[model samples]
Target: MKDRATVVCVRDNRILLVARERSRWALPGGRICRDETPNEAALRELSEETTLAPIELTYLFQFTGFNTLHHVFFADVAHHARVQPSNEIAKCRWFVPVKIATLSASIPTREIVELFFRYIRTLESDNVHRISQQAERVSL
Candidate 1:
């Protein structure tokens, strides 16, 4: 099985996506080199494909595809960051999570975004639950 690193770069509630000349849109990432760590590959791939360096990368989770193990990372980039598409990437664009379903992107791209959205919702709910629990304890 192959190992790959994918970066989900976010800015202003939008996600960064890249496309090759005739390929479907996808997250900025590539297969890990023999001597490179997953994190290193993700950073390199993001920069190489989009020319947008990540402020910082946070490992969110991982998933196994048919032939690849994907290591996913999240980065919050500045909205002003320049995105110069390289040879490997013909174009770059940003999309809100809700609008992603309308794009002709790769399956993994859609799945990743949906999963990320669910994760954020879960976190929000958990925080709310925690706060409510604390309030109840205080009242009791």
Candidate 2:
């Protein structure tokens, strides 16, 4: 399986998706280069395809698709960041997560997006629990 670096750029509850000519909407990323790490590939592909440098990028997880192993990364970008489609990208847009189901997207893209949102929800839940515990301890 080919190893690819996929980036998830989310802002204001919307995820950025890019499309090539006559292709389905997908995240901005591409295959890992021979001399570069996954992190490097993620950033490079994001910049080449979207022309937007993320404020921060973090490794998220690895996903196995039918013929590719995706090294997923999360990118933090400003809410007002403008994206210009570059290189092989034909168009770029931000879409609400709930609207993804209605769009024509690659299976891996759809699955990765769902997974990312679920992961975020889990993180938020954990933070709330931790805060609640801290409050209880302080009151005691």
Candidate 3:
């Protein structure tokens, strides 16, 4: 499987993404380096591409297709003050999920965008549930 890393960094309802000159929108990640673990490669790639460093990073899921494997990581980039493009990137921008398709982005990037929003939906639901429970307890 082809090995890669992807991240979903959301802040203010926008996701940090990297756009290449001749490519579609993509996450801030890349292939595993020759001597680096997936985590190491992910951190390095994220730093190099968007310059948005996550406070904490971890492996979330893997996508194996034919002969390639994608190691996905969901990162929180709240700590990053601003993001700038480095190598392999034409521009760095924050995109709302609905606006991603309007931009020139790759299929893999679109898929990652969908996954990120789905996760965000779940998180919102969980947050609402927790808030309701807390409100009820407080009323008691």
Most lDDT-accurate candidate? 2
lDDT of 2 at 118: 90
Which residue pairs come into collision in candidate 2? none
lDDT of 2 by residue, 14-85 (tens): 899999999999988999989999999999999999999989999989999999999999999877788999
Candidate 3, residue 79: the lDDT equals 55
Location of the lowest summed lDDT over 10 successive residues in candidate 2: 75-84
Model 3: lDDT of residue 1: 55
Best-first order by lDDT: 2, 1, 3
- Measured by TM-score, the strongest candidate is 2
TM-score of each predicted structure versus truth: 0.90, 0.97, 0.79
In order, how many clashes per candidate? 0, 0, 8
Select the stronger candidate by lDDT from 2 and 3.
2
Q: Give the TM-score of candidate 1.
A: 0.90
Write model 1 residue lDDT over 1-140, tens digit each, in one string.
99999999888888889999988889899999999999999989988998888788899889777788889999777668888898589999988888888888888889988888888899999999999999999999
Estimate the overall C-alpha local distance difference test score of candidate 3: 0.79
Q: After superposition, how far is residue 129 of candidate 1 from its true place, in Å?
A: 1.8
User: Candidate 1 — worst ten consecutive residues by lDDT sum?
Assistant: 75-84
